[model samples]
Target: MVKQERAARTRRALIQAAAEVFAEVGFVPASLGAISKRAGVSNGALHFHFASKAMLAEAIETEAAETVRRLTEAARARHGDSLQAVVDATHDLMGTLAKDIVVRGGFELAGDIARRTKSPLRKEWQRWIEDSLRRAGHSGELADQVPWADAARVIVAATVGLAVLGVKDATWLSRQNVTRFWELLLPRLTGRRDTGTLVSAGSRPPAAVPAPARSPRTPPAH
Candidate 1:
């Protein structure tokens, strides 16, 4: 049992270390030596746990996808019926992508891997997004018009593009702008405009205005 526990901890450390290295140097440029050094483990240990860099990359992709799946599921469970929930969930997903450099980098790596190799993780992510969209009431003729598969593709592609842009120009895709882009585009794709006035990029809606108080009536006092 102790051995198993130690192994699990080592594995976790390696994964965290790999995520950091990949985020910094990218999947292709990052080497096993750097990952092992980051994890404070021997190169042999990394090789023992993961056969090759491709395997490690796959693991990172799996971790990222699982993280997204959990967040999406939780959001749906909390706010499935409301359109705001859908919008909020989408924004939340983007926020996750933006905040976690490893997750963002892993997605780019997964795309590159898909082009060169048979990457099941990439396909899984695509399917998961499509499934989430369908569950969120984006379907039928509207689904046909937008096509959940195509919509998922566009959503992920846009995310990747935005992430790359942000990496190049830190201010290129601010969180506010990302939120607004989704708020505006989602309604068009879902054929639902439940959220009131789309908030502009970098600006939130103004606080609700209070009603004016009525004037007091004059009294006939001596």
Candidate 2:
């Protein structure tokens, strides 16, 4: 049992270290030795957990994909089929790109021509956006003029563009940037009246809210 726990820890450390290295250097230039050293694990230990750099990259991508899944799920849970869920999720994803090394590395790897086919992170994100848009259409949240496919394309393109640009300029991933994007686009996508209800800055996640705030305290009887 102890050995299993230790192995899990080592594997997690290697994945995180590999993500940091990959985020700093392109996948082609990233080295297992560097990952191992950053992880503070011997090369043998890294090899014991992962056989190759590609495998380690795969681990990073898988972990990143899982994180995105949970983020989208939480957003949907909060907003149901509202387009706001899509907006919130996009904001969360960009925030993740800015601060989460594994997610950033996974996205970068997803764009690498040599290894792009191996990573599903980008494709999965696009699919989720499409699915969310479709749901919004079904819920009558989408504007009459906007087709789900077109909306999905615009959103996916913008978000992916931001992620790519963020590689060189961290400012692209800032919440303000994402919020500004939604502020401009949501009005067009949902029309003027519906747009008023959506929060372009994205809604706060349920978990982030204080427990005491769930129900307001009643003042003493007047």
Candidate 3:
């Protein structure tokens, strides 16, 4: 049992270290030695946990996906207002992207055309947005003129763009930035009555917005 716990801890450390390295340098340039060293584990230990850099990157993506899944689920469960749920999720997503190393690395990997791995993180987010908007439309929460698909597309594009732009300027992921986006967009997307009730900045602030996840060039994580 002790050995199992220790192994799990080692794997977690390796994943975290790999995320840091991947975020600092693109996946193509990241080195196993650096990951192992940053993890404070021997090369052999890293090898025991992962066969190659690709495997480590996959682990990071998997962890990041789970984090987003939980985040979205919690957001949906927290708010009865479907639009509010999306607003809350976006705020949390940006929060995590700015604060979680695994998420940052995963998104970086997803955008790397050099890396052939297909990441589901963006798709998952888009699907959730689509579902939320669809629900809002059915419930009369959306404007009669607003098509859920179109709203989903716009939200996806804007969020993805923000994540990409945030790679150079983290300010793009700030809560205020997201709030401003919603402020402008919510009025157009929500029903007249709902618009008055929906908080464009999200129904609630995240519990805490941690320090930057990386030293520099922070983007929203996948």
TM-score of each: 0.69, 0.89, 0.89
For model 3, what is the C-alpha lDDT against the true structure? 0.81
Q: Write the per-residue lDDT of candidate 1 for residues 1-222, one digit (tens) a residue.
A: 866656666676676678767766667788899988877778887887899987887777777776666655665566554334344444555565656644665656655643376545446555656666665444342333666666667766775566556543545456676776776675666565433433323122322112222222221111
| Candidate 3 per-residue lDDT over residues 111-198, each given as its tens digit | 8888876788777888888888888888888888889899989998999788767765789999899999999998888645667778
Better lDDT candidate (1, 2)? 2
Error of 1 at 58 (Å): 1.4
Least well predicted 10-residue stretch by lDDT in candidate 3: 213-222
Model 2's TM-score against the true structure? 0.89
- Stretches of candidate 3 exceeding 4 Å from the true structure: 208-222
Screening candidate 2 with a backbone cut-off below 3 angstroms (N, C-alpha, C), the clashing residue pairs are none
Clashes of 3: 1
